[model samples]
Target: MAASVQGGRIGNLPAEANAFVGRQLELAEIAGLLGTERLVTLTGPGGVGKSRLALRAAHAAKAGLPGGAWLVELSELRDPDLLTNTVAQATRLTEQTLQPLLQAVCEHLAGAPVLLVLDTCEHVLDECARVVQELLANVPELRVLATSRQPLGVPGEHLLTVAPLPLGERDDAVSLFTARAAAAVPSFALTDANRADVAAVCARLDGIPLALELAAVRLRGFPLHRLLEGLDSRFDLLVSPARPRLARHQTLRTAIGWSHELCTPLERLLWARLSVFAGGWDVEAAEFVCHGGPLDAEEILALLASLTEKSIVTRDGDGAAVRYRMLDTVRSFGAEWLAGLGEVEAVRRRHRDYFRWIARQGEAEWLGPGQRMWAERLTAERANLRLAIEECLAAPEPETALELTGSLWFFWFACGFTEEGRGYLERALRRAPDGSGPEHTLAVWAHRLVTVVPEDLDAAESVSAAYVWLADERQLPVPALPLTGASLAVRGESARSAVLYGRVGQAPAADGGAEFFQLLTLALQAYLLASQAAFERCAAVAERLRTECAKRGELWMRGWGDFFVSLAGIGLGHSDEALLSAREALTAKWRVHDRLGAAAVADLLVAAQAARGEEELAARLLGISRRLWHAAGLPQLGRPDRTVFHREYERRLRASLGDARFAEVVREGWELGPDAAIALALGGVSDVSGP
Candidate 1:
């Protein structure tokens, strides 16, 4: 097992979803290759069990590697440029510097022995090749286990060809078949009477693992002879002479096509429509997006169940609400069929509409008792939401993109995907109609708010002008009011921020009427009051908001409320109270992966410590705050109002501790691992100097 390092655990491999049949030889060969080579590529066709085998190897070898084994699934990744960020996210390596992401990966794994399993790399061969090659050349101790349709072609890469199971005597294929069969039908077995027929069936299907699994699913409905007859007819129609490799690829394709042919028309339609989802979908989303044309909401569940039974779609989660997803190969086939049928536009529009409603609902209920649930749901639906956004942008009407993106203002901000949210807003803005409408104004305001990282002041100013032009001509809605106020507050216009926040009270305050809008407006109001050094008023407003948010189980806004309270406490000579408030908020922010919010809270804790004459610890935390600020891409506040306390604290710490000692202390903090840093901020420990 990987040796444990304090604060950083090594492994996060998911448990195998199904029984492991017979891959002892393949697993042993992979282990041997990993021991000798720095990069091992498992090359095979889709559904040929490359992912499964690679995952098995990773788990088997996890004990020896010290830094740990991690898996990054690249099948659903659409953008090649996000490859590094995606890997960093999978490995839980939060960036601590503005260096090139490749350099960041190298720095992270420079001295540690780690195994990185890059699954499904064929779709992104070029990008993956470049990243893997760079890391291999830079980090000597890093090993890569990649599963692709072909090799990544990097130097020092050992290719392992993963073939299908032996047909007749090895029992690998039949063992796989019988195992899956028993699940589909409890009475299923390779009895003496049926053993020959089952062997013949596996032989006819070429011993391919996925083909056998699908064939096994047929046992639920048909006897061995009937199932063999169906496969015979399907293969007779679809197959032709080819090379050994291409033939295996064709076999799996034929199997999926045969599965599609056996589905009911309603089931087939649901398959194609469900292809619109990028990830898994619950019945509610399937019904909402797939209903209305030859399919009723009531019929979707049954059809979905039928598809799951046929192994055309896989079911996940055994609760009352089961989620379903098609394999990538199957989804591709369905997408092709969906395009041929020309219902793509209608289906995609329905998908966009459903997700748009979800986003709007999230915005409405974000400050209530269901706040955390809404956050969790939005996170789960992110991939599907991306597909919806893609459809909106690609549709004839681009205004749908603008409106949908506009509805996600609070969701994006609360979830800390400000960078990605801005990219969507900018892309949608480029395609939006050049008019001053509700969506246009809303998109403009969202863009302005996202561009407020201090360095984007020029772009922020330009977008702000467009929003002001729209708001001047027409009254802005309650949700858009917070954007306007937050923009002013961050840009040092405290008076205008206060005025804009005051206008929110004039709007409707009903549960359905911009609840998050009202909630964030109050938080921003408290923030602005603190910005102006009105400590008493800031504490009063923040305390009230904190109590309300606590009642509703909202964390993001509540975290910011604690942040305001901490700031007020610091200004009011209450360092202990400030530290308590700061630590409480840090816990919440960390739970939500809100890096930007965590950075802000870290700074508050640092200041609170400085106020209490804890110079050494304060200096160390100050350095950590600097690292987090850079990681979050937020510029240092240059104005005296924001910088004076931080500057004075650093001055006092340096003067007391001496420059060299203070520099050593800050460097020690700079080397602090993520877990230790977070633990220090949360008061899990009083000191973070030890390993």
Candidate 2:
């Protein structure tokens, strides 16, 4: 049967490009088990179609899952510590707090009936078991379907061993081979002339799906008889006599090895070097990381295209967004070759350096028109970035870890990875040498900013003192000084914070300073002005910042400027203007995936609606704001000024709409998903009915 697609449901599960040949019994059994069990694992050797079957089951079961079926691909994730974060990211949970990620994931899943497919768990088996056990224990309604080479020994777990496809007449094995062969050679068919040869090839390869698919591709270059003859010689030469009972596994490996031998020398070398990358890579990354010695940078695109045609690399997306990735089975094969060739360390270092360059470039370009593009590109490369950091930490001198982590402060802060960023920064600092240079200092400040609990006044004071000392000793302006001021303001030291902001603005402009830092200073200054009840001055500063951002096509700081202007408008009793500015700020924040900023903007929206006598909408917005704040893990960012407005709005809303009515509407709004709540706030929807 062709791949199934349920109406009215779309998710992260990838679309199957080819027909799903068979496995009726297995699919039915899996469906039955899913109905009765919370944890079902499909265990099989590599290339035996475990992942394919799991995805098919997930797509078939998507309609019954209220929270949707999300597939978390774990083949690229090497660090056990990031398992929870990976799952949270796949499920679209934007964590903005320093709270344990697993706790946040559990909370997010507790409210819905979700079907989570954890694919390829063998690399991190123990951590996967622990996380799965914890999730099942805490989230009563969540069901986990895992694909691994072995079972994840959690309690109440069900294991289903996936065997090779049957090779009987008209069986799935023959059908799969036929379908793929037709795709490879469009004129090919299962006629009497080639029927026996096709069946023999499938049986020879033990009916392993990946092995059969590889053999089918060979049909384009060789006829059926020649292909079977080649496979016979390869299997005879490669299959070891010491492992007769492991025939299926050996068959798959033999097929991969045979395919490896057929490639040109350069193709084999490129495959091994590409193994260093953790996840998918674009053409430019491939050219930079894999080009050296015999391989020229100009030849990478054609090499990648050849690899894609041969099924060694799967190409995805289109145009400038195109990416190439090897399957887990194929990547493992290449990794082994990479190790045997003694180029693992060298290639891995090259990969690290390339990603480090990417980090520096992102930092330098973060305040310009490419801000959104950078945010997206970096988010997509998250797995590779983590791998790069891991490589640095493993190096003898580990100082580069500090630089890499510190440079990503904007990604960690404004792009919704605050918790992950803090963890990396803390790790880098621990491994850093004492008396280290500017990299260490930058990391210290970044860690402080990303991990700071809004209520931690002591930490805020230390951060302030460090910046002051650094600025005085260097006799240069510190661009991040305004951030320290903002931290103080969060702790209710508004008077001291105001002084710091003023000093930073009046300080001589540093040559070639980062525009992000400059705009951030202005945004905080305007926020302080609004908090101090200087509405007109606050509006002026915010407008100036917005105009500057517009000239550069920036979004992150522009969103903050819009938010401050809304606060000033509300303070000046311009309800309509405040409402419009709040919506505008929300649009920008959502575009950049700034969950914390969007949540804060939702609070302003509540006050604006209340001020305009939209009591029912205001009450609903209050409830929506509660959910947003909970997701952000910081209510009003723990700011006294923002909290006062929130509380007063709630009190007035409660009195205007009777207590019973207010409570009812608030509950209704609280039940909405993030997208629905944001839509209501932005006036895209009239009511919060569904996401």
Candidate 3:
């Protein structure tokens, strides 16, 4: 089937590119589920055609549903928090409103006849289950079809366990083998002489489609008799009488092993090294991480091509930057071989070193216009970064861990990995060598900077004191002085923070007056000025910082600059401009998962709406701010100036809307939940005249 469009809308289902070989019975059965079940999950082993079956079923169900069937591919999604955003993007639900993302999804699907197909839920099964359950509970007319390696375990989920193709003489398995074999060697056919041998191969593989396909590719390399002899020997050593059920699984393992045996030693080594990656990787990454020992950079591509041709490593995308991934089963096998080879530590060290370099590169470039690219690149490499941390901790090299974690300070702050970043820093510090060295001092300072969020005043104060003590004792420059001033600002000491910020801002720049540190120092000053209600000065400083952020391609500080601009606008009585700037600020905060930043923007948005006589919308945003406060993990994380203003606006809203209706609206905002509340805040208009 091709991508269908009944109206002008192109549904999210990928075009069925290849000819689907079989599963006619399974398709019909799953299709029958469309009318009866809200949740139907197809569970099976890897390469048994769960994804294909799901696409076919979704296609068959498409015409009956006016909203159309949508498929959300979960393989590439790394962060569970992004599940709602990713689905929102896939469904093209770009209507900007003051609604939570999940609420927006619900509002879009409410009472609509739609089919949502969630594919590859195994890696994110819990998150998938939660989202699916929420969608089902909210959208009565919506149905879900999911494909996974196992059941989603949600209540009332209808399970259709997909087994291998039948092993009968004229079954789909035999047909699949014959078809793929003919593709490998056009002249090859199932003649009477070779029919028994083909049947034996299919039966031996227990009708698993991937194994049959792999064997078919070997037709050009080996004759039927020789292939059968090799399979027999591998099975004799691999198959166990005690694990008869596991024998079915052994089919794919043996096929992968056979393919491995067919590779050159260097190819096998590359394969083993490639297993270290958590997700798909490009050629540059492969060369950086996998090229060593027998494998060199130039030979890497040729060896990779050989593996791809053998169907061991799947190549995806196009052009010079094609990405590659091993099937989960294949990757697991390669990982096992890598462990046996005892090259795990050496390979992991290289992996950590490469990603460490990447972190440093990101830090250096993150203040420029390429900042977004760096952020996204690092986001994609999040899994690898975690793997590097894991390797460091396992190596018991806390010093390396400390450096790696410190290098990623900007990433953690910009990407909203506050808790996770703190955890790694604490882990490294706990295990770090006890000395008054730079490494230990940097570790302590890095921990303090992350804890400098608005919600944790105690930790912020404690760290700020430490920085002061360290500076006094060392009689030298403290790298954390900038952060110490910022933490003081968070603690409502804006006047005191301003003095310290001025001193630090005038201090000699680090790393040869790098743009990053300049930007950081400037942003801290702007926020401090805004906190002191210096509206004109704050606006000037903020506009300058925003320009620098734009010029450098920086996001985090640019976002904060927008937040302060809105604050300055409010102080200067530019309500309309404040509302607009707050939305922009909220969008920036959303991009980085900066909950505290979002909360600050939400508070400003609430006041802006109230000032513009948007009482109900203002009240609704007050609700959003409440949920945002939940995200910030404190109900009163607003800066001192903003906190008092928020209360004053709350009083105005209550007086305008009346106490009862205001309370009701606030409750409504609370019910919108954090995700939808943030979305609503993001999409809120400058003139909030609506209820």
Number of the top-ranking candidate, with TM-score as the measure: 2
Cα-lDDT of candidate 3: 0.74
Model 1, position 658, has a per-residue lDDT of: 96
Q: Kindly indicate the candidate among 1 and 2 with the higher lDDT.
A: 2
TM-score of 3: 0.58
Candidate 3, residues 203-301, lDDT tens digits: the string is 766576766766776777779877777665433333322242222234556545645655679988998889988877778888988887777988988
Which residue segments of model 2 deviate by more than 4 Å? 1-264, 451-457, 464-485, 495-511, 613-636, 639-642, 652-677, 685-691
Give the top-scoring candidate (lDDT). Answer: 2
Candidate order, TM-score descending: 2, 3, 1
In the range 44-163, model 2's lDDT, one tens digit per residue, is: 656778888999999999888777788998877879999998998887776487878888788877666778899878768899999999989988888999987667878899988787
lDDT of 1 by residue, 1-691 (tens): 1223434557678878789999899999999989999999987545567888999999999889888888998866879999999888787776487788778877776676899999878667799999999989888888999987667878888988776677774389889988988987899877888888888887776566777777776677778788888874443333322353232335566645645655678888888888888878888999898897799999999898777645567677777446788655567678877999898888888888899999888877777667656666677788988988888888777778888887788766766667888889889999975845777777877777667644555465455466555455445453334555556667778777777656422433334444554566577667778877888988988887798788778888888899889989998999999999998888777655566787888888888998998888888887788777767665653233255676778788889999999999988777787778777667675432211
- The local distance difference test score of each candidate is 0.75, 0.79, 0.74
Order of candidates by lDDT, top first?
A: 2, 1, 3
The alpha-carbon RMSD values of the candidates against the true structure, listed in the order shown, are 21.9, 21.9, 20.3
Predict model 2's lDDT versus the native.
0.79
Better of 2 and 3 by TM-score: 2
Better of 1 and 3 by TM-score: 3
